[model samples]
Target: MQHSIPPGGRVSGFRLAKLLGEWRRRGARHGSADLAAAVRMLVLDGRLPAGTRLPAEREMAEALPVSRTMVSAALDQLRAEGLVASRRGAGTWISLPSGGALVGGADTPLVGSSMVDFARAAPPAIPGLLPAFDAVRARLPEQLVDHGYYEHGVPELRRRIAQRFEARGLPTSPDQILVTSGAQHALALVLRMLTGPGDRVLVEQPSYPNALDAIKAMSAIPVPVAMTDTGWDLPGIAAALRQAAPRMAYVVPDFHNPTAHRMDAETRAGLADLARRARTPLVVDETIVELDLDGDPLDGPPPVASYADDLVVTLGSASKSHWAGLRIGWIRASTEVVHRLVSSRTALDLGSAVLDQMVLAELLTEPESGLADRRRHLAGQRDVLMAGLREHLPQWRFDRPGGGLSVWCELDAPVSTRIAVVAQNHGMRLAPGARFGAHGGFERWLRLPFVLPPDVLREAVRRLGLVAAAVSGGGSVPHQEVEVPVA
Candidate 1:
């Protein structure tokens, strides 16, 4: 059962004001677009959970330092898109999609509005990314005269990506690197190229949802090997490989998503050996490899590819460690695999964007210092999120993640999806745990990202607590009261 805000209640002026961060810094034309885009992004992203009351136009304008006209224009645009609805006396409220029609579509509002989103597991673009883009703009003229297609990737980018692997103790060459739009694209390409219909693929339980979707899109049977808060089950994985004999295995070794379990060196070695024996090529997603916030700063592990050079296909991306907007990712594999990916990619698209590639190349050439800065920023945010959760939602439980963007939380009731639904009414967006599992499991879990600033995160958790209370009959159920399986 979901609860609604009392009539005439308005969203806090402070929260509405925070939504205008940096919009004024851009100038009026850009400011209006930025303001509208931020609000639209919030609604679509489920942060402005359905039914959240919008601040009065005057209130918003006063708080954000924008004119009333700009605020009205933004609101009018939102109203035209059906993301907001207003009445004679009641204020405007956020609306949800109707009959699968997204926010920018149908004229009808499905539900109400929300103001905070905990669904996004991605980090904000670093303050330094803009400077990198400016540098790339200066260098753009050098490459613009030539034909702007490089399926294998720009030479400098390939070299930098390969050099990153080499720096991490896995020797590589530019010839072994094939750049793609992002890790998801790289994973999709690998799945398409390697697996045929009816082939079996091994994956971690509670794996990245998009990766699971990619496997299913290929019509490949997914054999999930269970992972825990501790790490992967080596024997179980080995048995799955032996039993299912999957053609390919996809694993996220460092700072795994959802669970945030990093594979130990021994487990990595065992999996590599198992995959090699099964002749199964492991597609390792290392997007979060450099985000090791808890480890000794100097004691970084080598790439898993270092152990099984012949069998592992390593995927690297600028998304997790760097800015995702750059949309740059690469695959480091055998030269033969690289060649095949290049040939197969034309069927998907030409190469990545030229400007993004150049920008990423500059970022990769000097990544460690930037990654360190990111680690510190994330660590602080992570603490804030953990502390907030402890204070507001004391009944829920989650192990502290050493790295990665989210905390995989365990709710007391088997109502993770229900909680998510009820949360929308309270202006919070959440990803139900079932989305992460290959099978319809994890109904008692949810992945909550600590990517937002401290104050926003505190508000999100506070809202989550309200929804959790509603779902749990005014109190959290004890773990012994329910026997849900952990992923």
Candidate 2:
């Protein structure tokens, strides 16, 4: 019954150190200034968010492997700048200089106006969406006569969504579906059903930030398994399953976020077998499954739920494939699990928006048909963003994402947070690498979404290159595309 997130989350020393990556430059001099700048970056980036308690100086110093004097000096500098507020007993927490959020704050230069939002990796509605809505409107009068509450979602939508699974070579029944507001909402319900406070949940090392926050919100611990060069670390996951005995494992095997790694059918089978042996529920998120930029998503690997019918719970969303504005997503589990989810869902909300559900039903009535234009559109944007990245910020290295909306870039320097903070002032917002980490690591990584128009993407990356140069203390990048070699 208690659902409110605690007043604030207390970030530990080790986690704080990980958040502040290779904060100090090559030369160790001016440690205080460097540390202050790193903390300032985290605060401004909203990674260290307001009301997040900072660890003690001694603990932070030990974790940062720096002198206590340096830590004190750094905090003093931050306090002087009005970016931090502290008391003898209350300790320190993040605070804006002008007592407002960085975003839309009067004194802050971030996202003031005409800002290009690179943080959100989603696209506009498809052309077919308007027609879908028109189709729904023709039938809205009939639906309005009903009770207007579907704890298990509208029947038409459930059937349409279920048929999508069948097209992907995974048999699904409408009775096995439970629709919700979105995938994030679906995940929240799953967490409520499967986990309790203090229970451990297995997750990818650099997993989705929102998912990580969800786990922590439940007071459950996240047991992370680092991803390998190729894909999932099977042996490492197996070890964690044995050691941690987590309640459930949440993963995005289909075009994973941030890294954009797709799991082959073989890996899916391996993961299913592992979950079977450990008796852990495999919660698979297939949000961006239909965004296969290279080939047909239908012809790709089978749904993860097909590998272990009874043990797997699949989450799907039209937000990525179609449009987030639809606000329609669902859960595909066994009949019993679906019933249980619906039973628990009443505590949250009665159902999703009826009109949006009807529109999605109309869109998915011809499943792959509506998604083709979306894929083609995203592919063009992906190519443009990739080309712009190579031309403008060649010091960064990133693999071509087979699918998904973003490019997972590995910067030459561990300045992802620094670059993100600087980018805010450049009329572009960025999510730093550390935000994806369970304990705030991944300093060399940053996820750049290619969801903007080709022209907008070009301008955004142009500004990004400048931000990178400024952070590295280099000269301004030329407006003309110049490919620099990445060592």
The local distance difference test score of each candidate is 0.76, 0.82
lDDT of 1: 0.76
The C-alpha stretches of model 1 lying farther than 4 A from their native spots are 1-114, 296-298, 474-487
Q: Which segments of model 2 are wrong by more than 4 Å?
A: 1-112, 474-487
Cα RMSD to native, each candidate? Answer: 9.0, 20.2
**Which candidate's lDDT is highest?**
2
Model 1 TM: 0.75
lDDT of 1 by residue, 1-487 (tens): 1111211124565676664345554677766667777777655433354446787888888888778998888887777777776776656776544442212112222223434557667765544455577789988888889999999988999998877777777779999999899998999999998998999999999898888888999999999998865888888988998899999999998888889888778888888888888888999999888888886423666678878888889898888777777788989999998898888889989999888888778877667646766777678779888998898889889999998888989888788877877776676667788888898689989898876655456666777787887887844432222222221
For candidate 2, write residues 1-487 as lDDT tens digits: 1011111346789888777778998456799999999888666433554445688899999999999999999999998987877766667766556534322121222323556677778765664665577788999999888889999999999998888888899999999999999999999999999999999999998899888988999999999999987789999999999999999999999889979999999999999999999999999999989889999988999888888999999998888887787888999999999999988888889999999999989888777665776677678778889999999999899999999999999999888777777776788777778888899878799899887655567777888998998989954433221111110
- Write down the worst ten-residue block by lDDT for model 1: 1-10
Clashing pairs in 2: none
